[model samples]
Target: MSPAFSVLMPVYAGDDPSHLEAALRSVVDQSVRPDEIVIVEDGPLTDALSDVLDSYERAQGDHFSRYRLRENVGIGNALRVGVRRCEHELVARMDADDISVPDRFERQLAVFERRPDVDVVGGYIAEFDDDPDDCFACRIVPTNHTSIAARARFRNPMNHITVMARRRAILEAGNYRDFLGMEDYDLWVRMLSNEATFANVPSVLAKARIDRDYGQRGGLSVTKAEVRLQRSFYRSGFIDAPILLYNLLTRASVRLLPKRIRGRLITRYTRTPG
Candidate 1:
């Protein structure tokens, strides 16, 4: 039997209305539908985005729970608030612009049932641009707990949007924090430090939207945040000093690259032919 879980998603004013509708539909259409979807409005949303949410609420009824924040507090805080509102002990993170495969929740639930020690389960993601039907690239990560722990020393081993984790474990690990562009990585580092088990399903169970502006979101500010996270990990003994230095330099270099060059590098290193 599939373990019941709640989907936690944070939406901001900037999200594309059409994408939000598709994302919500994907979750509602899951093979093992979530018990509830706790959506936190980071702040006031555009009329179109609000309309989309209202329509889902009407269609989904009690399965959709919406919360609002008076001001935008960013993704980390938004998710932190949403997590607390989740009714189920198992909480699945879903981005407002991403689409999960029909069996995504079912597969992750099976992992929890088979491996009681596992606190978090994620999977590979197929990245698409303009059309969801045409996914061009896949982002694969380490599949086992050991590999995931090792990979965490250098980079985020889990895809945030593809993760389903125990709510208690997340809260115990200090929950989400404002980590700039690396909130998920920051949480994973803390969770690993606290000995929370992690794994990936080794299959593409989600589709991420990576439009043209995706690569442009990173720059010096994001690089600084990455360096800060690495340093924190090293100090917390999650990563060694050498690994910290290596990440700082490498991440900074990538952030300093020309936008076009960085975009190409990101695509080349992060994605494989789907």
Candidate 2:
């Protein structure tokens, strides 16, 4: 018998309507179908989104569950609520804007079974240029826990959307917390502190939606990341001086460097053979 998996997803009030359906389809079409799908409607969603989710849930009937939040409690809270409501021993997280490949669950489940020491697993991601016309970026994560955590101080190895974790380990780590913008980062640190192991599957598991207007490399998101990185380093007491200096230099050169070039430099330096 295929092991049951629960997918916990949080959808904000203003998510792209089309993207939501694509996300839902990705899960429904997974090679190893999930036993339950929990969509936490974070805060009161838009009427259009609500209607769409309602229609989708009705179509699935008892195959899925939708947990609607009366008030906006942020992603961490929504995820916590979703986790509590899940019945399966394995929990996979899906983002409302990303598309999971059909074999993602099957591959992740195999990893979990093979590596009993690993408490969580994630995989490579194919990032699509959010532009209606052009393709932009794609990347893969390290497939080993030590390698991933070795670089964790610089950047997160696991894509939030592609994470699958053991329910017991997650609960023992105190689950997700309210960390403003870096909730996932905070949780990963906590899990590591608990000696919970993590790994990444070598295969591409999901497609991330990224656009020029997304402003991840520049603008407010970058600023938020800078603050969050400093805060995480302070809290973890594990940030390396070399990595810190390298990150600062990249941030300073953001305006002078091309996006792809800067991205490559950062990714390379952080994930360099160490």
Candidate 3:
């Protein structure tokens, strides 16, 4: 028998309405559908975004649950609230602008069934522009526990939106905290520190939207967050003092670069032809 899971997503007013629609459709049309989808409106949304949510709720009926916050809370707090509302022990994270492949959930579930020791599993993502059919690059990550743990020392080892995690483990690791752009990374570090195991499916299981503004998303503030996270890892003995210093200097330098240059560098190194 297949295990049931809840898909958790947070939508905000700033999201492109079309992208939100596509994201919702991807999940709803999955080969192994979610038992429930818990979507939290992080604050008041634009009429269009609200309409998109309304359409999905109407179509999905009881399978879809919606929660609205009185005011805007960041993704960290928003997700923390959403996770608490999930009925299933397994929770999958979805971004408002990304599209999960039809078999994504099924593949992730298979990993859980075969490896009970893995508390979290994510997969590669194909990055696209305005059209989903035109994928430009794929972001791949390490696939085993040891490799993932080592990678987490210097960078985020998994794609945030592509992850399916154990609800108990997530809550036990302190749930999500307000970390701005580094919220997912923060939770991952905490989970690793708590001895939660991680893995990634080698295939691209989702399509991530990337545009000119991608580079601007990680600025000085994000760099500060990374430095803070790296320090936490060092203090927790996840990495040594020398490794921490190396990470701090390199990450900070990258973040301080011009957005265009940073974007080019990221594209050049983190991406490969889809």
Candidate 4:
């Protein structure tokens, strides 16, 4: 039998109620469903979202759990709390708006079963706008440790929402910390620094939601955060001076482009590499 696991999801006011419902359904109805679903309400939610939670609570009963924060904390902080509260040794991360394929959990767990040395496992994601059936792009990452670590030098090597990690490993690596947009990347770098084993199943495990504006790079604050993250990468020894300078220049130049052109460039960079 598969070991028991928990799914940790963080949702805030910005998440759509309908999308939340779909995400929950995907978890409970998975081909190999998790024994526990831990949802962290990042802040007080809208009545619509609360109502959706109410319905699920009634239907899911003991299998479902909710923890609400008095105020808004970012995903990293919300996950830090939920990770500790989880009862199982294996924890899967999911986004409030994305939909998982039915066998996602089963496939990922199989990786752990086969390779007990792996501390974390992730998979590819297909990006969809209004309809999942019409995924226009996919983000593919390396499937083995050497390639994954090498990819980390320049980019995020795993899709955050499709990750399943050993609870002990995550905690030992200092749990999660708040970062503007690169929290998972930050955590991965620390895990790498600690010599944690990693792998990815070679498949699209989830259909991630996206919008027209998803590709648009943010303003000054976002760029600053990117620069800050690259610096963190440098200090962590994931990248050196030259890689850092190249990343900053390419990122800053792209952010200065017209919105449409920037969006196109970002989307292209996000797709499966040639």
Candidate 5:
């Protein structure tokens, strides 16, 4: 029998209701369905978003549930709280604006079956502007534990929106914490330190929504967050002084470039055409 898993997703004010509906529909139409889906309302949502959730809940009946937070917490904290309420050992993370591929869960589960020592299984994700079917680029990562660990020092080794991880492994690694844009990166680093084994399916697991203006989003605050993240990595011994300085100079400086330049740089190096 396949292992039971729960899909954990969090949504807030900024999420698009239409995108959320599409996201839900993608999972619902999966080749292998989840036992349940636990949605976290990070804060009060617009009536439109609430209505979308309501429809899914009504349609899914007992298979769907939601937990509302009294106020807005960052995605990391919201997920930290929400993951605790999941009723299964394996939990897959989802984002309201992303659509999972139909066989995503089945593929990840197959990895776990073949590699029982793996604590986390993730795969590549496609980045699309308007339609999931027409992806422009893909974010691919290393497939084995060794390469994943080595690459984690320079960049995120797994797609946060496409991972199926063991709840026990996550809790042991300290769960998700608030780190602005660095939450998933931080957690993965900690999990690596905890000696958790990981693998990737080497195929698209989900399609993440991106805007044409993706490069224009970062600013001074983004640079500050990058600095803070590097410092944490240093303090945790994830990186040494030399590697830390290298990142501050190379990665942090990239963040301060003109929006067009930054976007071009990211698109040139980080993405592959789908």
Candidate 6:
């Protein structure tokens, strides 16, 4: 049986209203329409933002279900709140700023259909900038269970916002939690520990905005979050000391490399569509 889908998006204070419209449109325009669209306004959104959302909702008709958060909460908390309100068995994540391809939902659905045992499915992403020449290619996670678990002990393979997770499996893994900066990684580790399998679609399913503004918090926050994830996995008995130490060192080394080199590598790896 094909599982119904709930597309969940959490809106933060700094989101671009125009961008939000495009993101929402992608969901509404999906090849396989979701059963519900759950928008969680993380806090009191700006008037302009609210107006845009209002317009989008009116246009979407009965396709969407919106909610407003009376008090400001962090992204992790916002996501948890939104997911709880989902009425479907499959939860698809959409970021306020990212753009999903029109076929994103359809492609993800196919993956789930092919691998009924898989609990989550995501895909590759392309990084874009204002300058066309500055784009890079990246994969969110591995496309099969073997590779997924091979790299699972270290870094996050799936982009949280680009994933479609089995609702029941997510609940069994304890759902989203307040992991501060590394909520996605924390959740992935917990899911892995529970023996949940993950896979990514081979095609690029979305575009991720990666710019200078993203790492502003000294990048220490992300690093710290990874450490917390490591602690979680260690405590869960999923990984021992040697493997954890190796992953930490390897991940740190990759981050230490220059951005120019990283960008070049990423660009070189991805093929330009004809």
Please, what is the TM-score per model?
Answer: 0.97, 0.83, 0.96, 0.95, 0.97, 0.86
Reference-based TM-score, model 6: 0.86
Question: If the candidates were sorted by their TM-score against the true structure, best first, what order would they fall in?
Answer: 5, 1, 3, 4, 6, 2
Q: What is the C-alpha RMSD of each candidate to the true structure, in Å?
A: 1.3, 4.1, 1.3, 1.8, 1.1, 3.4
Give Cα-based local distance difference scores for all models: 0.89, 0.78, 0.91, 0.89, 0.92, 0.77
Total clashes in model 2, counting residue pairs 3 or more apart in sequence or in different chains? 0
Kindly indicate the candidate among 4 and 6 with the higher lDDT.
Answer: 4
lDDT of 4 by residue, 1-274 (tens): 9989999999899999999999989888899989899989999999999999899888888988999999999888999999998989999999989999999999999999999999999999998888878887888999999999998887789999999999999999999988776789889988988899999999999988886446655677767778888898888777899999988898755656677787677677778531
| Best lDDT among the predictions, by candidate number | 5
**Per-residue alpha-carbon lDDT of candidate 5 for residues 109-219, written as tens digits (9 for 90 to 100):** 888888889999999999999978898888899999999999999888999999999999999999999887779888999999999998988899999998654863467
Model 3 / residue 24 / CA error / Å: 0.4
Give the lowest summed-lDDT range of ten residues in model 5.
210-219
Which lDDT tens digits does candidate 2 get at residues 190-274?
A: 7877888999988778878875233335445555656666556655666666766665665434624566665566545433221
lDDT of 4: 0.89
What total of clashing residue pairs does each candidate reach? 0, 0, 0, 0, 0, 1
- Could you tell me how far off, in angstroms, the CA of residue 17 lies in candidate 3 after the best superposition? 1.1
Which residue pairs come into collision in candidate 1? none
Q: What digit string (tens of lDDT, one per residue) describes model 1 on residues 1-274?
A: 6777999999999999999999999999999999999999999999999999999999989999999999999999988888889999999999989999999999999999999999999999998887888988888999999999988877779999999999999999999999886889899989988889999998988999986435634677877877787788878888777887898887766887778787787778877886
| Model 6 lDDT-worst window of ten | 212-221
Candidate 3, clashing residue pairs?
A: none
Candidate 1 segments exceeding 4 Å error: none
Off by over 4 Å in 6: 131-134, 212-221, 250-274
| Tens digit of per-residue lDDT, candidate 6, span 78-166 | 88888888998899998888888889999898888888898999887766654323555454557888887777776677877689998
